[model samples]
Target: MYHVVVALDEDADRARRQSRAVADLPQAAREVRATLLHVFTDGEGASATEVGAVRRASDVLNNAGVDVEVIERSGEPAATVLDVADRVDADCICVGGRRRSPAGKAIFGSVSQSVILQADRPVLVTGGFEE
Candidate 1:
């Protein structure tokens, strides 16, 4: 049994995609536990908007019967997710990815890539339904 940390974003659609992806993972049912991680995603202050997103995600996962937990911290997005992974001793991390054209990747860089480089554990990448 290993810990799996999922990178949850502020978007409701993205979070739902992530939840379904986690449910489909081959290891999801076999794993001892799953941690549905979402960072504050703000620099410092806790915005009421962020609070709502977190609650929305928490409720979604909980209703799905996920062995899930929410992690809220103010920091860099990728850094916060990686920090949570370390804290939970996650064996693997999963994150939602948007469609990135080659040029787009060159310009904006990839959030999933950042987490992969920053985290000690293996990272899984998934795209939303439209992506």
Candidate 2:
């Protein structure tokens, strides 16, 4: 089975989309195991809302019969994601890139962009949430 890390931020809809993207990966020959990851930068534990988001994504993947593990970390989002990927030996990283203009991204930075640039493994980026 292949292991994948789903980067879930505060956006619940985006998190769901990322989870669905992982679950939709071709499972014809081998099963896909998913690690639902959320990072709390303050080194605090996950908040209730964050936990709820994880649960929502977990439910989607679990209901699809995909092996799922929920992981919460304390650190910078992109760096922690890469760290977790290494620890989990992830085959790929899945994340949602919220809509942002070139100027905005340049000024504010982007976790998705950082992961795509630095990740040693494949990174799957989904567009922002849909209605």
Candidate 3:
């Protein structure tokens, strides 16, 4: 079976998009095992909203008859995601992307960009989302 690690953020829309992307993957029913991962950079545990979003994502995969696991990690977003991917031996990493101006990106780094550039495994990015 193919293992997929989906990086879930606090943004509900983005998190849902990431889950939808995983659901849309080929062989999702028969060959996909998904882990919904939320990384808390502050070392704090998941907030109520975060846990709800994770549970919602988990439900999506579970309803599709896919084995799902929800994991929470504490560390830098990109680094922690990579660490989890390595530990899980993920076949691909799924993340949501946001459009950012050059100036904005210069000021704030992007976790999706970092994962795409630095990941040893394949990374699938979902973007162009409304809301």
Candidate with the greatest lDDT versus the true structure: 3
Q: What are the Cα lDDT values of the candidates?
A: 0.70, 0.84, 0.85
User: Model 2 residue 47 lDDT?
Assistant: 61
Give the poorly placed runs of model 2, Cα more than 4 Å off. Answer: 28-30, 47-50, 129-131
RMSD of candidate 1 to true structure, Å: 3.1
TM per prediction: 0.75, 0.89, 0.91
> What does candidate 1 score on TM?
0.75
Best by TM-score: 3
Cα lDDT of model 1 by residue, 20-118, tens digit: 766666655555356776665536566423565456655665665567766656667788788888888888898887887788779978778899777
The sequence of per-residue lDDT tens digits that candidate 2 reaches over residues 55-124 is: 8888888878899888788879999999999998999999897888878888989999999999999999
Model 2 quality (TM-score):
0.89
After superposition, candidate 3 runs with Cα above 4 Å error: 47-50
Whole-structure CA lDDT of model 2: 0.84
Q: What is the lDDT of residue 87 in candidate 2?
A: 93
Q: How many Å off is the CA of 30 in candidate 1? A: 7.0
Instruction: Give the distance in Å from residue 39's predicted Cα in candidate 1 to where it truly belongs.
Output: 2.7
Name the weakest run of 10 consecutive residues (lDDT summed) in model 2: 43-52
**CA lDDT, candidate 2, residue 127:** 86
Q: Worst lDDT window (10 residues) for model 3?
A: 42-51
